[model samples]
Target: MRDAETVTFGGSALNRAAELRARPDEIAALLNDPAARAVPLWRGKPSIDGAGALGWVAANHPVLRDGEEPAIFLGSDETGPLFTIDLSAWQPETGADPVPASFFDATEQRHPGLPDGHRFAELRNIMADLSARDAECAATAKALIGWHRSHRFCSACGEESGVAQAGWQRVCGACGAVHFPRTDPVVIMLITRGNSALLGRSPGWPEGMYSCLAGFMEPGETMEAAVRREVMEETRVRVGAVRYLASQPWPYPSSLMLGAVGEALDETIILDPNELEAARWVSREDMARAFAGDHPEIRAPRRGAIAGFILRNWLADRLD
Candidate 1:
């Protein structure tokens, strides 16, 4: 994981301006500055122009609603003033009696003013051809917008909340509580024993698609422990001595994938059907074939995803 921060969006190291979020004056300064730009959100998706999808901000100044202000200024890249916009004032551009699209998926309703690519997909398949910078922008946009949608209610008081911290936090007027966007931690591991690795398929995955075994890290669990526990719980493969490999900020609603390479003490898989449709051991040779698209029955993981990155490195023997 030495080059972890070097990975795609992981590399940006944006300062995320946490301290500035709480100060109303600082937030106002950033918003009113001509250099400050707003990244548009349609439904929960980030608006993408061509260039790989991550960096574009909305051209218009966003109007704040309900006494809420911006929170969470995701620090600067080479771009100037990389601030997020919270449109609690958003109303569907649809017909009379328009409502917020956050209540449902709005990927199909293309806004006439926005770029065609400014939308969401379950997988960022479009990023396959985008430049590194665009991909980072796309990832940031998706993560922030999704955070806004899910945090409309205050966790502390269960009262309806409004955006603050630019677009990174929510505040409840009822009990004077504040909430911030959450990035759930998940552990994805390439479990290995000798020359083979473990991969599993979820019930609804595309035919022949298999990738690293992953599970969410529970509260108070260390990254290494989460790796071992998840591997054991899903495939009954006891793992020992987990080693951190790399990570990806999978912004499909905000998850930070903690990728690792784990030494499997035992290989016999007792798959919990509820967790996987099938679990199996694949030799390095077969994995290479899958990577090359030569395997008749299996497909390697999709590129730009953490699973694919892990598998590619494992094949290159770079995980060491």
Candidate 2:
């Protein structure tokens, strides 16, 4: 596989086995199979061990007993069929609760039922350390479970929806409306002109941390167009000749980040205060220092994010 394809939360090529979603009996039997294992999540955080590997427990493990919903069928591998169970209902100790509305949550929650090192850790904190297969599985589990939590009611009719297809879908009993998981597409572009790259920081991001500008794709807009539009709207930077580089399944509430590079037509930056707290152009040399943790006023983008992936590739001339 190309280096670009190995971005975190992608390129695992796991057999999703979508056909099996409709087979309820087969899925039920697989749940009982001794070889089947499940990854558990507590309030959107997955269990990770001290070694940074995702912790898996047998499907019938006591830690999974309290989830209000059925286990989500991820896919099959040589080990057997894989599943994920949501334990959001499992609350932690009083002081260990997650901070509300924080940009980064460093709190770790350990269930009494789980082993000592198997604590539910924030995905972003451990994302760079997970194996490709573990990253894919964790992303899939987080996205699917989050979708279910937010979409419990049918939009067509104000009726509560029920889990169906082993968590792949929701069925509205009142209106008979069937719904599938939604993935919002966001374009994150590394816009460049000459030796400098345009980078921006959002309001709540940590100080001195800047990354490629990104925004959600509007309806009926193409990826290239989204890239141009977002940059222009946020920084008034006109972008031309956009090209796709890579993609990552960012499951912080389920977004597929479309990574791209755009040539900047001008060096002028007019920042919209509402969209960006600050914006600047950094030369290749300064960016290298940021990545190496040597820059005094600038910090590197979050590790395992597509922004960092694309920027690193651009710096190495490996975006191909």
Candidate 3:
């Protein structure tokens, strides 16, 4: 757990000046300040240069004209006031548009108003390559903006809501209801018995891909219980003691991944076809080979993901 925050999308200590969220006067001044820089996101993709750094534009950049709403303040870094603008309203050309419901979208869209090499790229493709601060800001931006896009109505009255609290919340004019951004809790655990770790592949995962068993936490369920229940439900593997490990902010929509380690009570494998396509216990030797690209049947875990981070630490006996 000592290296908990070292995971990708970990806290970067960005000063998220929450106090200014309530002050419209100060927010207006910051928007006009020359030092204000905005990170542009298009359809959930953050604009980045060819070199993997976030593509930051001046607050008044013309490309921001395509944004569906006003920029959401991220926080202050070394680069003065930082904000994120959602340009999902902009449409890409035919054929070059993103592939719908694909596992990974490799296409990049370049706006005519932005400089060369600045393209809105998928966050997963470059998440590991970005600096800590960039990753943190990008994750926050995507989650916050995505929330605004989906939760435009008040659940209390089914009426339209207006942006409030600098995009951190929405307020319904009809019912005086205030709703805040939401992050669902998910438990991704490394389950082990003896010298092997339990890994499973979902139905749509890439061929040969396997990862720690994970599922969303249900209401009134504890993290420990979630870990045990998920493992049992997916592979029918009974897990005993569960211990908290590291965590990562997984903003592919919005989720906080709670990483844990669980001791399997038995090594039997019974796949629940609905939850997993395959499940197996992999020995340390075989897992090391997979990580090194030498295993024929098992592919290495994706870099920058909590599963890989946890597995690598478990292999090196650094889970302390």
Candidate 4:
């Protein structure tokens, strides 16, 4: 766990500029600054350049226009200021990344200023490849954008909400209600009793691809309690001595992954069909092989994931 913060999208330490975001004029000033930069998203996919890095455009890039309301202020870096603009409405001329045919609104969008080979890449596909700072910025923007899309209406009064607080909040002009973005808490546990740890796969995951037992923490539930409950509910393996290990920001629509290590009191796993498709214990040596891509039957959790982080640390005896 020496380099625990290196976990993908775990802790990039972006400044966020909370005070600057509170000033209406500063927000506008930053947006208009010549040195300011912006990241573009089409159908929620990030723009990537030929170098396989985030393709940040100048604030004045033609793809950015003033008419777009709710332009999210993503805070400033050493490069002056930053923002994000959703270009989903703009149609591409040619040679753009095609929206997945399965998408509800299928179309391709490519910005003219972007290099010929530059295109929108889904974060999930490129997260592991991105530098820690780039990954954190992109994930933060994605989560904020998604929140704006889904929470445009006031939850309390059922009225429309206007973007406020430099893209961090929505204000209902009608009822004067203010709402903030939410981050769902999930507990992903590495439960071990002896030399083996427990892993489980949901119904639709690829065959042999399993991860730590994880679930959303319910109301009034402590993190430790959530871990124990999720383990027992899914596999009937009673867990003890649950404690925090590390955390990751899983920005797939904004969920915080709270990694934990738990001691299993009983190794007998009685799977609950509703919670998991399959659950079992895997020996440490075999798990190590899985991490090295040589396991005969089990596949390691995806790299950069908290599951992988916890498993690797456990294998290395670093979870003390």
lDDT by residue for model 3 (187-246), tens: 999999989999999988899999999999999999999999999899888999999998
How do the residues 1-320 of candidate 2 rate in per-residue lDDT, one tens digit apiece? 15877889975888889999999999999999999999999889999976879988899898798888999999988888899999999879899999758998999988989877899889999999999889999999999999999999999998999999988999999999999999999999999999999999989989899999999999999999999999999999899899988888999899999989999999899999999999999999999999999999999988999998888888988877
RMSD vs true structure, all candidates: 4.4, 1.1, 0.9, 2.8
- Clash pairs detected, candidate 3: 1-320
Write down the lDDT that model 2 would get.
0.92
Give the number of colliding residue pairs in candidate 4: 0
Score every model by TM-score: 0.82, 0.98, 0.98, 0.92
Candidate 2 stretches greater than 4 Å from native:
none
Question: By descending TM-score, how would the candidates be arranged?
Answer: 3, 2, 4, 1
**TM-score of structure candidate 1:** 0.82
What's the distance in Å from true for residue 133, model 1? 4.4
Over the full model, what C-alpha lDDT does candidate 1 score relative to the true structure? 0.70
Whichever of 1 and 3 has more lDDT, that candidate is 3
Q: Could you give the candidate ranking by lDDT, starting with the highest?
A: 3, 2, 4, 1
